[model samples]
Target: MLRQAQHERVHEGFAVEAVDLVKEFGETRAVDGVSLAVPSGSIFGLLGPNGAGKTTTLRILLGIIDPSSGTRRVLGHERPLEAAREVGYLPEERGLYPSMHARDAIAFVGALRGLPLREGRRRADELLEEHGLGEWARRPIRNLSKGMAQTVQLLGTIIHGPRLIVLDEPFSGLDAINQARLEELIRRQAREGATIIFSTHVIAHAERLCERIAIIAQGRVAFEGSVDEARGRLRPIVRLRTRSQDGSWRSAIPAAARLHNGEWVFELPEGGPEPLLKALIDGEAGIETLAIERPGLHDAFVAIAGDAAAEAMGHQEPSE
Candidate 1:
């Protein structure tokens, strides 16, 4: 038991790592030179547009398919199949037997992942009850609502207590309330020492849940860093609201200040905040509220990838 538990810890500690990953599907290059790592107890986010190689990259990591080039390790095992028992994966394309009850569907997946049928059934019951689906456990999956079915699918994925969970577009059918519930569930899993890597196009989920994220565009890695680190790269623009009578502030305002909606929108002088604040105190602008208009990860994504995201989906925007 000790050896097995220790091995599980080791596998969870360095749950996933990849280097120079590339994959080609005949005529098209699906993934190109991507590298990333998901450390234990952290929620790592994979972000990209529809054809940006996110699915191919995840397929390689999960061992569903091998990369054309590069290397990856999961659960401390070089072989994906060998590590399968310790990893739970929720694929973007969901599959559940429509005629099968929710409990049976979950137990089936659990058994396939190496859990004893009895233990798996016990867990399925517990989870169904916990997720407020106890009343529907015996109902066929085809009878459940789409969101409820998705919730059940996720619960099944983790029923066996896998050390690392990889979720692909997990919020697809979930409503806002259930989405928040899933995010909290992810946080709880991280607190319990499980590493999670989830793919999503939603920036808010990535911002709220991920400690670190890797942005992929055009089948390649555009950026990889912590959420705060990503925010630090952009020029911090602060909008200061002030009035003419405020002689107490003058020198500290940026030279590019413009009055809009009763607020002065200007880039926080690259010189730094201390000097900016010092100057504000001496400026004639009656400073009301000092608000930093930060370019969040979403903004960075747009800046780095241009309109490829929207364009890929066949949408056009008005000229700037």
Candidate 2:
């Protein structure tokens, strides 16, 4: 399958690169010294809370807006607009003529990206049918439901078969079912060899979709690496329930261990659990239950971005 090939394919160079990008609006510095390198044919995520400058950074990378003092390259072009034909962008603010037919709207967007009008129309129909919107092809944008209209805009975004696609909050305002569908669509696009970069405050989506991510907080990058690497910032947790309330087994527990609801929880010991388990057994500490739990993305995010940023993210999506 194409996805298999994509996994096997060795990426040579970055599809997009930005160096110390800084965007300022008068006294407000929106993006401060942000840098990123998106691998070719990879799904990269820009994760942060609202007003964290993710949108400003994306705009700077795409040349939609100029940075105060920074440089960026898109698809190997020093000037992002020079490679406009190979890139597709979906802004945070969704807009389409309300009176335009769905097919026509998509075709028009394709035409802006250099796709021939006739071919664009043909591809629009094919995309609509493939996505279960064939019957609504001729429907006016104003008449379509919010989800349907958003779907139409998404279809239009990819109609040109762009090499690099940038989406700002792509899952915002989407229903659960439509959000799942959008996630699949993003995966399919990556499978087809497109480099996808999307910004979202919802950590769950980023955790599931992106191999590498940049966590932005207060206009600065807090962390940039693989998901596993981010999670590795905190040690795995150990939860234990002991039959004996007081014994030598308590000595084996770390000083930081805390008892909550009859369970002793603490960070995993550095030397490994074998010694601890043996100590528990040898000390006559009847172990009712013992489990090692790895820290998840949310824990990592809280560790990296601090409680305030995590609270901002919490308002948008539930953490795992």
Best by TM-score: 2
What would the TM-scores of all predictions be? 0.89, 0.94
The model with the greatest lDDT is 2
Tens digits of per-residue lDDT, candidate 2, 182-212, equal 9999998988888999999999899999989
Candidate 1 residue spans exceeding 4 A from truth: 1-13, 245-252, 255-258, 310-320
- Assess each prediction's global lDDT (C-alpha) against the native: 0.80, 0.90
Writing each residue's lDDT as its tens digit, candidate 1 over 1-320 gives: 01124434433355788999999889899899999888877899997777788888999999999999999998778887798987889999999989999998888898889988888778889889988999999999999999889888888888878888899988876777888889988887777667889988777788899999888888898889888877777788787776574464655666677778877777778787888777766564556788888887777777666676734523321111
Q: How far is candidate 2 from the true structure (C-alpha RMSD, Å)?
A: 2.9
Clashing pairs in 2: none
Give the distance in Å from residue 291's predicted Cα in candidate 1 to where it truly belongs: 1.8
Residue 235: error of model 1 in Å? 2.9
